[model samples]
Target: MLEPPDADRLYAALLARDPAFDGRAWVGVATTGIFCRLTCPARKPRPENCRWFADPRAAQQAGFRPCRRCDPLAGAADGTPDAAAGGQGLARRLMAMIRADPSRRWSEADLAGLGLDPSTVRRAFRRQFGQSFLQMARGERLRESLRTLSGDRDLIEAQLDAGFDSASGFRAAFARLFGHPPHLMRGPADLAADWIDTPLGGMIAIADDAALHLLEFTDRKALPEGLRRLSALCGGRIGLGRRAVTDQLETQLDAFFAGRQPRFSVPLRLHGTGFQRRVWQQLQTIPAGQTRSYAGLAAEIGQPSATRAVARANATNRLALVVPCHRVIGADGSLTGYAGGLWRKRRLIEAERAYAG
Candidate 1:
């Protein structure tokens, strides 16, 4: 059981019906349709109808439809608020600074200066963000390295431009993250790409002329599958090959960052289970920047009650950006759980919304 303060905050979200806490807390309705979020605005159900969980994932396990008005998943998660409240909550502050500056190389001393115990900073960041602060910073820096390397910039200059203080550190980080060194990025000069900084972290763009072909978050689980499929799709000898198409896609990505509506018309080479492919196909028709509910997606697939199955398929998608999995949200209009993390999902959608203009 959570402490009184924690429980109270969850309950208050229920009482005031704030959508901000939708995915963070769920409310069970003993009587009507199903469990909902504290932010559910469909008229308060009976006290007997009210039960709560720490997150929507739990509530969904209990089989609840998002209250239509509250649309819990849309405004689902609570950011690391404990850090925001406490005096210089070191963990939170360090995370915030890192999130804001992905290219900065933060030292232990720097983190200690931020009011965090150096060791604590190391462990907590891994626990919260799935990686050490330094690990994540390196990932971000490498993204810039990849973007520059695949473009017109010289390899050595790209390494320096990405803020690598030492050649050895830069080479090591590059090899570790991208499976190759900055100078060895030789296969394709034609493949276009750019580094996209999202709230969740950074992602790489791999596309050709006329359309955006690939967009994969370096850490996304779908990455392995994408690589495998790429080999198969390109006929087994999967090596980098530069093409004019790559440059076109890079320009398209640049347009996205600049808040311009994209003009991508390239065909995406997607791979997944039949069901997942079906779901992804549906996602493509969803427009460049609109959203759909998990339930709505299931219904569209002619499996009106198989919303969970649809969500499962979505989770397994190997082609991340090309398939546009981030376009899907919870039925109640709230953002739902995304394998890539909720924050990145939100940023992707928000960024795309601007792109739709």
Candidate 2:
């Protein structure tokens, strides 16, 4: 029932038909008595004829029908949360079950005990979250176990808390996500990995006491290998926790997404070659709401011949928003490549324009 804080921003997104707001926002056209997704293909409505709502139900309640072109209520039919509590769909009920006892190790048999088919639940969850329901349950259990790691609980205790019956099983699951076994993280931790949820998506932030080390979207394909490399370098020093720098960076990120000029003061420990560091340093100079071509960026670094290398360095940047690698585009003025996905790059560039001046 709550409107987005900035109607102007949502309206801009509607005008642009921004795909980043496709699922997160909807527009109710007062003139046409219709509500459509932000990415709807219908002709744009005038500003005075627009009303904003967080979800389709709110728009419908406000006397707007779903647009025939966009079919904004499709997510509701598919069992995705159109409302905060969500509909009484199978996926929502399963999520409620997971919340009731997150530490329980859910199995196919457990689902079958409730007269549910495993494959049916898997497909429903996969359609909604891109992962099977069991994977989601494991993630929930892992989070419960991770919370215990900050305390004095031993690894055996943590394993039991996560519902893992064997030490080896727990270690394997932990290694899969963290890139190292639990025993390798025995010493006093100097670097910590924390999850930060943003409007774009979930990001994993790794930092030491002095500076932020890495910040990348959680779903990035390179994330697992990056963590593996970091684990090899830092050895036993990194684990699940957050440092003061993490707190500072999270605060800055909040302000940035809130349409403010973020002064990213958190110290950065860039891990790259000398040439790459130079490229990244030059990238930091590209002001928000502005873009630089790979060739342009290469020229700025006194390496006009190294445009391809500049693009490679840009691709390898682990600091998501802090370094502003999203500002780089193709020389022909197209968004060529962004590790965070082009939709996010477009959204970031659009959002930064609010305070770019």
Candidate 3:
């Protein structure tokens, strides 16, 4: 567990019931052995009896039960509707409509027509997604265009199909974001990158029309270099966007983290040499809640003498949980060489073990 926060600041937040600190910190009362959110409505505890934790998990690990009144795990200040919920709901509804028909060009006038405040919708979407509604819609349109292009559709057709009114405008936007014009794309077309938020942290997912190329925690030191290598290997530019494969991967990850799913079915676009691909494929076969030594993986891949090579391939793997590289350990059974950090690797292995039972 991490060290607790400053006692004075946490106590101030607890006394004021600050909603801003809702998920950031939890206060545990030593006398009652209960943990509550910073915004808990219950009376604040005295300074001497209070302890601050970074998260609910930490509080739980410290032997504190959740307080019934606040239910800090739910990620809301109280059971009542939050001030941003209505606007957020409307933004989500609008997003759904936009995603359902990527060819549609939505505008502020459309929101007004729907009896919604345009500014409120914009603010809510920006707050939740960190982008304007129009930007997201454009990304969706670009994703659709890429999918169409993968199907051998012509550039003009793809542009119109993606809701763009002008060919030049489409070409410019595509080039600006992807670092290349759409017509210049060759081969199977590489992957688009998207961010996925998980309980552990934010992850970067890269995918194309047909398969997921990579999924790695954002904090991995080698991620940027790996992405560059993938772009060069696939002969396609990487841009900020999503594809059908990425969306599916996100859903599967959500289930896997929730312990409701044990395997991923999203197709993979393994971008590596035949030997490395074989190593990654073998890694997937090492079921959840199990660990394999580098030597074991080398043997499984029919290269028993290439344990070091197998370990190197595992270290280079960009797909983290889906590829199960974390399942590979040292010959002595110690966790080793996970780019996502040994702490995360340990937690992932632990979660899988508990779920597998």
Candidate 4:
């Protein structure tokens, strides 16, 4: 029973057949058994055929196929608290426990004792989260386990430390997820992260839960890989680790989202080719609110003919606002490729521009 937006707002968008409202909400046609974003290019169906929902995942469970034009699988506009909680209000708590000790194991009875039916929790998670509770729980634990293993702890200790009842389970999960075993994990100890909220949505800063990791858009394709790199670098399990870096980064993120030109000085942990890193480093010098072109950055980096490479590097940057890739635009002053999606890039630039002005 999630309510749609104001009736007039929805009505107005439908009358105009607007595209801007597409990801923010959806229309489900009971008659046709299809769901569509407002931007779906298909012919607008009759108003009587539309039963609206805020997201397509819900509509899909109700048995509506997504319109091909607007692939609902792009994911919802940042999960809401209810979406985050998934009705049990345990997402945060569970996330906390997992982060607190990624290697820790909780039996079904233990989880059920926390006021959740194991089967009900499983179904709710699968329906609302698209992952079974155990799977989600396992992935999270593996992250932390990997993080811990990468540290001073050796492989066997790290394996057992990550809460795997046996070394075999730990090794199997690691090999499956990272394409390698724990010994491959390597990197510095500096943690990095930054948070931002845009008109489209909010995204958390990614890291080893200890040091800077990936400064990713919540909805990007390579975000998962970025986390893997961070976990690999940390050589330990990466369930939300408690760190001073996270606290400072969280505060700075709040300021950034609030339109403040806040100074952020967290040490960075970047992962990319030497060329990509060079482009990103140049990007960091673009000032808090000013922008530059890829051509400009390429030339400044003494690679004047590498404008395209620079663009590709920028496009591949896992970190978003911190590296200031959003500050790079086309030579024509038009916006260009941003992995976080153009909408978020536009919103960040606008917010920063106003701040600078």
Q: How accurate is candidate 2 locally (lDDT)?
A: 0.77
* lDDT of each residue in 1-357, candidate 4, tens digit only: 012345445655766655435445677877778887666667777776777776556777779987777665443234444332233344445655755765667778877687565775564454434445666667656656645754577777777777787777887776665445555544443443333433333344655444555665444556656666766766645442336665666677767666664455766767878998899888888876688998899999999999999989988887677788888988987778787767565556655754566
lDDT by residue (1-357, candidate 1, tens digit) is 111124444565577765434333467776765766565567776565576765555566777765666554442233234322211244457667765775677788886675555665564455445557787767766765665666577666877878888889888766554454556555554344455554345666555454444567777655645544544554433223334555555555556556564435546655566777788888777876688889898999888888888988888765465576788987676778776766456556655654455
Candidate 2, residues 1-357, lDDT tens digits: the string is 012337777888898886556656678888889989888999999988889886677787889998888877753554445222122256778887887997899899998898666776675565445457887787777667777776678989988988888989888877777777877665578788877767665578999989999998866768777888877777657877778998988898887787664557789998989998998888888887788999999999998999899999999998888998999988877778788777677667766665565
The models' CA-based lDDT, in order, is 0.60, 0.77, 0.74, 0.63
Candidate 3, position 350, lDDT: 64
- TM-score of every model? 0.52, 0.71, 0.51, 0.48
Clash count, one per candidate: 17, 0, 0, 21
Which ten-residue region of model 4 has the weakest summed lDDT?
81-90
Give residue 243's error in model 2 in angstroms: 3.8
Lowest summed lDDT window (length 10), candidate 3: 75-84
Models sorted by lDDT, best on top = 2, 3, 4, 1
lDDT of 3 by residue, 123-189 (tens): 5565445456777677677667766766666778889998899998898766654446677653443
User: In candidate 1, which residue ranges exceed 4 Å CA deviation?
Assistant: 1-105, 113-133, 144-185, 188-194, 197-200, 209-211, 221-225, 235-267, 272-275, 287-290, 303-309, 318-322, 332-334, 348-357
Candidate 3 residues lying further than 4 Å off, grouped into runs, are: 1-190
